[model samples]
Target: MKLRMKSLAVVMGLLVLPGCQNMEAVSPWIDVGNQVVKNAGYDTDSKLARGIKETLYTSTDRASTGLSQVGAFNLSLPSAARPVADGLRQFGLGSYVDQLQDAMNRGAEQAVAEAAPVFKQAITGMTVNDALGIVRGSDTAATDYFRRQTEAALRLRYQPIVEENLRKTGFYEQYKGLLAAYEKLPVAGKPELDLERYVIDQSMAKLFTRIGEEETLIRKDPVARGSLLIGQVFGGAEG
Candidate 1:
């Protein structure tokens, strides 16, 4: 589907506002939009579902694309493994550590690509009941629903891609070499971590964060009300 980039770009800009981040701020836009749809000879249920799905697609597209860039994941070695990482750096092997960090982030970036199809399928499956509930629900209601529908499936799909990218980036080899170096240290503690699982989990968490931000923008940002139907469904009621 063709994304309405003009609309989504406005929504993205609105997200930078502190007030737009308030998940508890209520607005009557959705109700007004619903009324408008009702009066426009459009079936409220179908229009609501389509509008939400279209919005979600734009949101998910932005999230996935933004996250695919290098350094986008912004994660580091877990705290438990920090000592080991520090030790590696102390031995002038810090570049290796940096490489591993970049690899993990890159892996996660690649893994995020899996989310698009999953979200598309999930959004496509959205029920009229789901649409009604989301329209009447909290600011993040749509995001919450999207998460419930896609989280498990996303995890299952993200892991292998993450693992593959990690290997491609030589993270495993560098990690093992670092661990070998750390073992030679006179330290009594060995830091253990599941890097693959960590990347998968963090990637999913960040993906949801992006989606939630978009959902909130749609609910609260007047500029996000782009299309005629979208504006009608999300615009404020002129009292």
Candidate 2:
């Protein structure tokens, strides 16, 4: 009986010892990081919407180059609309340049509004596999996927609006002016600017930049760890 009691005491002592307790390390950082990604993706969608809106409102150039005949016109006219005609003359176009700018901006704004929700859903639904693939692929692969998936549907939805805006804003007449100007220029092989496509591409590029920023944070920030798997996979310390 004495021997058995001594053995039991030893077993109990071993069980109670801190090092023998088989404790696992718990990391809160991963969870925090995941939540941050989700939130940032959502926030990025909002920023995308705002950026599109601002770009439309403030943009004077149909090409979105920030410097254009329209901007020059605005500066020259200052108060009156006469510089618009002068701008057309400088470009050797007709009186339709101003109208084209308006039409392009309107189309861009509408396209962004229609596409924002789809983009948000895509970002929020991104899986670990998707993130990993993005990390492994080209710098813009994630953004490219988002664009590929969304562009067709968005273009289909946006085309009618763009067409209507173009007609309403007299884009045909504006294009005539542009064509006239183009004919006078020595430059050849002028690439056609598909306004809807350009707007969508630019927006996707911006969204990718935002997603990449969040991803970088997830990779670097220990406090953003949101899961046991993530902690186990990424955390260097033995649990």
What TM-score does candidate 1 reach? 0.73
lDDT of 1 by residue, 1-239 (tens): 12444443333233222232332343244344445545544355676576667667777787788898777878898788799789988999998778777878888988897678888899888898787667666666788898999988988888888777667665567765776787687877656467877788888889889877876776565345434444434553211
Model 2, which residues run further than 4 Å from truth? 1-87, 90-95, 121-128, 135-141, 171-190, 193-239
What's each prediction's clash count?
A: 2, 10
- Model 2 C-alpha lDDT per residue in residues 23-118, reported as the tens digit of each score: 122223323333443443423223223322222222112222221223221211122334655777698775465566566556545544565555
Question: How much does candidate 2 score in TM-score?
Answer: 0.40
Poorest stretch of ten by lDDT in candidate 1 = 11-20
User: Positional deviation of 64 in candidate 1, in angstroms?
Assistant: 1.5
Model 1, which residues run further than 4 Å from truth? Answer: 1-42, 169-192, 222-226, 237-239
Whose lDDT is greatest here?
1
Among all candidates shown, the one with the greatest TM-score: 1
| TM-score per model over all chains | 0.73, 0.40
Model 2, C-alpha of 190: deviation from truth (Å): 5.2
